[model samples]
Target: MSNLYERSLNVIPPVAARATKLGVVKGEGSYLITEDGKKVLDFASGVAVCNIGHNNKAVVEAATKQIQQLIHGGHNVVYYETYVKLAEKLVELTGGDTMVYFSNSGAEANEGAIKLAKYVSKRQGIISFKGSFHGRTLGTTSITASNSAYRKNYEGLLPSVYFAEYANCFRCPYKQKKESCSMECVEQFDDIFKRIIDPYSVAAIIMEPIQGEGGYIVPPKEFMKAIREICDKYGIYLIFDEVQTGFGRTGKMFAHENFDVKPDIMTCAKAIASGFPLSAVIGKKEIMKNWPAGAHGGTFGGNPVSCAASLATIEQLENGAIENGVESGAYLKKRLFELKEKYPIIGDVRGIGLMLAMEFVGENNVPNGRAVKNIINYSVEHGLILLNCGTYKNVLRFIAPTTVSKSEIDEALGIIEEAIVKEC
Candidate 1:
């Protein structure tokens, strides 16, 4: 038998997972075909990047046409139609009058947003929540305090960030009785701001409208409205990091829309280009005022190819993709809820739209890590690629394509049910 996995040398810094066998050969709609000719149902959607689904003809054709015409341009010095179109679409969807800065990834977009917040406010501190996963880059890493494993080795410079517990709702951070809790998390932030970070010193308060990697934690509409009021009262810029929740992952185009609140600045990347690497920091015009000609620039910031793909993706979303996302996401969540009722291991199955997750907790409501891991591993082996996240690594996050079919969801759920039953 020919070994699909073979050699390893030195040059490449290996990832913690399986090494020497970590290549993906090709991707079709909702599946990836590996080099060894294995078809893997991609539920993770490349970490929630492929919103429109894989091999989408519109995205591919747009990218191909751009590549055939122009490959590179100093984007800062040029006024390309594709880039301008993208900015226009973003503004229209956000329902905010703002400027935009293009970047290579969500982290870069967030970094730009951070700089803009400080530049506009001249404030030093940034307030972020615990159990948040921003990105691996230095600036974003500073705001993120998710896992110690990701934070252990890297030392040098994370500073001036304050943390307040967000509305976990399911798992109360204060250990307060669930019945008596009245969004005390928001009240806790009042104390955090007064004692730890002076409102004047806080440039921005950044958070995911719906916590993505912290196990799809969805807060109540009132919580968001309350925060908006706090930011308004304090003149602190509210930065919504919609890197995972934007572009129809949530039932609304932007999760913040679900609430009657809006952010002063928003950063997005995943699902922005429908599998292409493109991110943007969009903010109110006043906040974006200090942007000099060259303050932020990347070699591939808005490469025509990616921009074209993004424009096409955005157009499709505006037309009907997002509408379908709402319907399909509702269906997926409902089906998962049905499964949860049948299975006691599913502690909480909650989400909005296609952004969904199941937190596994025992009968006593403590996190069940082994059961969650078994379900994930078994589902992957059974043709459905499952993902895990949470402070305890016990939440099963489902981020398949927004275009995922009901039939596919049914099949995946069946496999998950069997796995949980067998494992438990």
Candidate 2:
């Protein structure tokens, strides 16, 4: 029989391409058991979905129990224990003043979030950052500006959408340095509202707390606060696309907590349900309540098994997983900084908690995507899996499981360093 990758070539389209071709039969903790029987250290974490680690015992048990009880009860038709319970848990976690709407994927949740904003606010304009990736749906594609390729040939997207520069201090869009920064990222809205679209016309402003596909760019606390203020001033809803930064990936339950700022709306997925397909559009009660019965609906939005998995996943995160992520993230970041000092190719290292990244650059700080490509290939060949991000694909992100141990991080770091030494 042909291997999985070989068999896939005839059936799967290139659009479903993956970072690696290694087909795995099973996963345990931080490692994947490949069909060829090699144990590959998984730092990709299924692109931050298997956050609590692959096949976590509690998650497995919860999902198994739920499956035995119920498989699918359409959210639009009926209520279930796991689904309602998970929403209550999320409400409690998010300050008891918010409500959640379930969906199947990050893109779906984002689509719902924007719809909620537009429905409640009765506005048509939406503002998104230039380097943000909301989702792939046509509705979300209108608000996503991370790459032109995502929008290629799919023009005439949702209109009344505007763009703003994200706060990337490293490569400031306005060319301002950290020391001399005038918060142009925030002030740009003035021009946007004046030149692009009226603030009053904007229903929502969607952004990733930490730009995922664009690069692991973390905006400053002041920037977040200012954005909140802007939304408050204009009576426009603020939406955080936390698909890649929610759960325990950012040390905190959500990345917004790091800035001490709250958004009117938030979208979550990826790590929400261990490896289960689950996503949520979490909005303040005031806003969510305004979005009545028929505003949004989905058949498999709140899968009983998925909700059970999410609850177990949240329980794991609450117990000690987040703390481990904090400690391990700090260690990994410090080690990465050391690597940066030792290698000129490492132009920058940034990100919070386990969502860290290293941007490779060549002569005069030019993006070195080739170097990143080579390093990822070399690392995989040597029994480690990694992923790349950024519009230029020069940024290598580390999405290690929050439950990762010091020894596991050390091992991954060793592999990374070896790859750097060999490829860079």
Candidate 3:
């Protein structure tokens, strides 16, 4: 076969140039079997989507049984037991008698949260942080300032979206040292809230408990607490984007649980459905009460099949995997710290639970995304898959499925070591 496919789709993007990327035949647990029968360790886990790991028995059975019964009758009018049950489970897991509105992806969930915030508070301005990635939808895109590529050519987007500095210990955007900083960025809030816009004009303060696309940036404890206080002071809702950190990815049911600071509105997706397209806004009862019944919904927002998968996924996490995330996350973190001592290219290592990142920096701690790219490519060539993201794209994000075994962890680490030292 001499590659007969023509470049016929310019409407999508000319940048999507590659064809015949690695093909996978099947996935079981932490390994994906390639079309050529090669076993590749799935460290990325479809960008942290497959938290229970690939081919979970219950998830497969639930999807299969739902398919046999009913795939999709449309979620708008018709009622489905699975959908209701999953929502109930969400309410239970999230606690506080919270309500949920379903969507199809992380972006949609965030988008819905934005609408809900404004609807309830009747406010317009939305505040986000630099290096934060909410989603790719127009509304979510406006808040995402991590990369120009996501915003370029798509300007004049959703307006009134403000940007603050995401917590970066090494590169503190607030002009403070990591150890001595007094959560000074919160001061920026006073200026913005008073002069830039009235407190009543603000809708919500959207942030990640752990900044997901922001190099897995983890703010100090008091920082998030102050954010909560700011939201409270202004009567603005705090939206925790738990798309990547929810469902045991952060070694807790929700990342905010660790800080004792709760969000008024929280969005969850990705792992909620064990790879199915299901997401939701879990928020305060009063705040979410403004929805006028059919205010927000999707054709497949709570598709019965995906809901079943969500139920099963939640069950898995609640049962024991949250604990597993803690144990394994500690083990993995310790190992990465060791790697940092050996590989000077690893300028920083940070993250919680199965979510982690290794920043490649120059001697002066300048970001080196090129080196990170080289390591990712080499790791893939050596039978492992990894991802890179950050303000500089100079970080290797290691979000292995929590179901991964100790041996698999060691194997992937070995491949990463070789890629770091030998690939250069």
Point out where model 3 deviates above 4 Å: 1-20
Q: Would you list the C-alpha lDDT of every candidate in the order shown?
A: 0.83, 0.93, 0.85
Clashes of each: 0, 0, 0
Model 3 TM-score relative to the real fold: 0.95
TM-score of 2: 0.99
Q: Pick out the ten consecutive residues of candidate 1 with the lowest summed lDDT.
A: 1-10
Give the range of the ten consecutive residues with the poorest summed lDDT in model 2.
415-424
lDDT score, residue 88, model 1? 85
Model 2, C-alpha of 36: deviation from truth (Å): 1.2
- Judge candidate 1 against the unseen true structure and give its global Cα lDDT, from 0 to 1: 0.83
Model 2: per-residue Cα lDDT over 158-258, one tens digit each: 98888899999888889899888899898899999898899999999999989999999999999999999999999999999999999999999999999
Clashes of 3: 0
Candidate 2, after superposition: displacement of residue 59 in Å? Answer: 0.3
Task: Please write out the lDDT profile of model 1 over residues 1-424, one tens digit for every residue.
Answer: 1143443424434553541143467888788787778887788888888887887888999999988888777586778878888888887777758878888899998898888888778888899988887888888888887777666667664678888788888888888765687778889877886678778889999999988878789887878898898899999999999999888888777788888788999999988888888999989887787776666667789777888998888877777878888888888889888888988888999998888999998879888988888888788677788788887889999888877788888888889889988866
Candidate 1 structure, TM-score to reference: 0.95
- Model 2 misses residue 168 by how many Å? 0.3
Ranking by lDDT: 2, 3, 1
